[model samples]
Target: MAAGDIIPVHLYLCPLTLPGLSSDQQGRLLDTLPLDEQQKVMRYRMASAREKGLLVRCYLRALLSKAHTQLNQSSLNQSPLNQSQLNADIDGAIGPSEWRFDYLDKGKPVLSKAFFARSQLVFNLSHSGDYMLLAIAKSPRLELGVDIERLRQNTNIHAILNHYFTRQEREAMLALPSTRQRERFFDLWALKESYIKAKGLGLALSLKSFYFELSETECQALSFKGLDARQARLEQAARLFLVKEDSQQTDLGNDPQQAQPAAGWQSKLWQLDDEYRFALSLSSTDPLDLRCEMVSAQALLSE
Candidate 1:
């Protein structure tokens, strides 16, 4: 696929936890980046890997299969490949079935502005301690970001608030009852994290600058800072979903008819069944009932 082509992700939850993952690029993506960038990527990667690494890998492989169908088999046959660089090279070709860019540093020696700016395609990989969330969308659909945290320990919600929450957000968070507020607080945090991740511009964009309509009930996007965050709005493209694997919510394996191909994620909020708190953003497209396809990370793997 050309860099400008439409490449949307279909998210998934890996069944493996962070500690459960142990192979290749299955659990550790941060190591590929520069040391400085590692911390930021580590900020999120460690969470997913620590919590949902295994499941994330399973789900990601499933998502890749979906993209694989769209690939021209003949073209794939003609491309030169090396088994050792299989994953990296194929990633260079088809991009991600589910990939992301937010924490990518522009000044880093390993990553370039052009690399993260592959404007047409974007996907997200997130995990806490037990569940990994994978989301895919067109660059035009929704600029999306996501963070998964294990529901462990004290969660230290209060301390983190001082670092990222704006005055208004902090007030809004505190105004609610403690129990309910904690849950809502996380949703809002995930929403903001997801927003930043999708922006791909990283910390240069202030967390408080863009105000997200994050409620337990809905997902909304608004730029409060009037910063350049506006361009991050992915226009026209839709966020569609297909199930390559099953989770807690729906069961597609029972219905063969459900496995039909989809036009795109036009407008629909379908659940894939992993319950570690998953949400999606669509740019704006019509909804269509399509079958979920599977793309192999191995498909991207060079022969």
Candidate 2:
């Protein structure tokens, strides 16, 4: 495949607290959203929950608008049409507030067909604790999902594993030392959620139908500071597997080789902070090049 055919995924992490927007700015930002989105934001019972919802939607619109502009500019450069026509096309481009959305039967939102034709962008949104994560890829062929979880000491890890996880997955976590079990639980949960979200099946797909085999791999040293620097120590490479009950030979620790890899899917896990675990899944057979950056509330809103 040519270089242009390969999909590139972009991750934007926005913290809800840093450089918080004022009341007036917040109202104006809310006003920019579509009616349904504004109502959705209002439905959040708690102030914090409402703020997170607002930021995620607004940032999504800003990013989509930017993507649309870049796509248009790229096409304009290649078109034989004169500058006058190009200028007219640029003026006709849709704004963030004007964008439309459609949702899958399972509640995963996607760009409406009208706007999708102009830019074949696919995106997924997730939030946990004080941060919201947005994953975007610019190809109709690509599907993307991202999830973040803040590690907490009060979670009932064993009960959850027993109910939702595959036998192999449960055994792997149980075998771990008690001190590490919580972290391991969140790791698996984030990965599984990302996979389901990527598939757009939500909880309609049984969690036991699939499992992930996570193993440590050496990652490249990060030259940049801040989040990337912390990621150097926390990121672990993982592979996805499907449960084949009839075969009955899948073992968590002893015989990983017997498991079947889930083809055309790729996932990565990262420790964004001391308290948060993040994972991303993409439907692509090609090598993945995922770029991540932390964007502040001010920066995202200003864009």
Candidate 3:
């Protein structure tokens, strides 16, 4: 949480089934959003979708505000400042309306320069079925992307694999026992989504251009049902191979070592529940310190 210091990646998972906000609570949260965002939330045709959108946005703002306050306090504490001045500054938390964002060409949103200048806070969010996840970090050099998928039996696994996965990846996945193929499918899908999202290129970066190679060790690690927040360590689960722009094949052959490792990038995968798989990708050369928490809607609003 200290300014200019690398901090653990903090993951917050909120369930959509939490009690709905009262009208007053909804109004107060809506008031903090920009007009455009407010309209976007309201424009959702389905009431459930609208509520989900509103909750995510408000929870994100609340988390950002808390982080900003901590960063501000840290900076002030490191400087030669009177206790009263520090208290005053810390008390003046960044308001939700004060946050500004800019989107990349493919629509990944980032903090505007004005806010980013204070502290290099970065975050990414994903939602699936009944859950929403937010991953945040506080280092200038860190980039984060997180994905949560509700595994569904009806997914057209072969069609998607043929279209988006590299030849080797498809072969490797299909080689798995029939009983495990569906779980493996979601695992790779979540990992690919996380990588592209972390790169901030969205689907513009072809999924077929790169593939994940989980070592025997990594595969064993991924088998665990849940991650202990204190022991969550991101390892190099995949290597990136850039294909020739005009070529559709990955060309890495059978040996993954033939391709260069994705430097400064780390990833971790976890089975969140019987129906969900989660993946996180981050750009960081240092070892990761990660914390995962399940937060309630009331807790988020109280903060």
Candidate 4:
């Protein structure tokens, strides 16, 4: 989106389906991508992983194509869609130069160039079990991250809680009834992962250093206890983002350059289906207008 556009957060979920997408169709999708991406997809040994990678990239391109078109339409004061032009733009497609991506030192990918100097567009992706999730925001000034996980019964829950959670967090989770404990574990893990992804530090930010305390009304971020000063500083700087309902209380006085904890960070936990949990973390100076959309593998790969 253009600079300062307040586009809704786009969350896409695609199931892993092998039908409909023929070998040639798959090849065509791969052909549209840069050679490096093609090589990476080709390198995946697992069939599901390879296909998931392919579909995720293509779906992202389609969404970007749509976003770019909308951005231009707004600038020209045009209607949301000029059907003919919109279809052509979606199908003909633009090259990747406009949206080339580069990763942070910690492996979080970011847009390398904005359509306008002030564009705030940012996005993040996560995949698990039967679905892959991609979160995109229209603003260039916002930090965005998303994570999805399918419930799994095989993991050692006690070990995970002990290893990754704070003593307080572990106790809190364990206090839940056994049936709900698993769900809570995944919920907390997704929250932490989403925050790390939003910060663009990935796992370089220690999981154990910070924790999210959940309640019916709000999720509180506990003071971080990192091993060193830098992690400690980051933890101290982390602020829970404000939602649309909480916007009136926000004070926009913090200096972005100071790396302070008051940086607006809004988070939400979602239940995609009975089997999956999703979490979103965004760093924006204002409240987040989050939205989610689900698509099947067929819809994503369709002509």
Cα deviation in Å at residue 178, candidate 1? 1.5
Per-prediction TM-score to the true structure, in the order listed? 0.47, 0.85, 0.83, 0.73
Top-scoring candidate (lDDT): 2
What are the lDDT scores of the predictions, listed in order? Answer: 0.43, 0.77, 0.74, 0.63
The local lDDT score (0 to 100) that residue 294 gets in candidate 2 is: 65
- Each prediction's number of clashing residue pairs: 32, 0, 0, 9
How many residue pairs in model 4 have overlapping backbones?
9
Best TM-score among the predictions, by candidate number: 2
lDDT of 3 at 101: 88
Residue-level lDDT of model 4, residues 1-303, one tens digit each, is 343445466565556665657787788778877888889999999876788888887777666655555545454454566778666545544444335677789877776664324345567888887667788766656777888887899978887766666554577788989998898888887788898888887666666555566766433331212221111001112234222322213322223332223344566776655677778787654544444455555554464
Per-residue CA lDDT of model 2 for 133-236, tens digit only, reads: 78877777777888988898888887787677877778778898998888989999999999999999988877877888788777544221234233424457
Backbone clashes in model 3: 0
**Which runs of model 2 end up more than 4 angstroms from their true locations?**
1-5, 18-20, 71-93, 221-234, 245-259, 300-303
Choose 2 or 4, whichever is better by TM-score.
2
Compare candidates 2 and 3 on lDDT and give the better one: 2
How many clashes would you count in candidate 2? Answer: 0
Candidates, ranked, lDDT:
2, 3, 4, 1
Candidate 1 residue-wise lDDT, 1-303, digit = tens: 343344434444343422333356543443433454344444555644433323343345445444343432323466766675556545654333333323456321111235334434356666555445566544344455445544434678898876666554577678889875666566556556554555566677566454333324343332212111121121212222233333213322234343333233223222222223434543334331222232223322322
Error of 1 at 253 (Å): 50
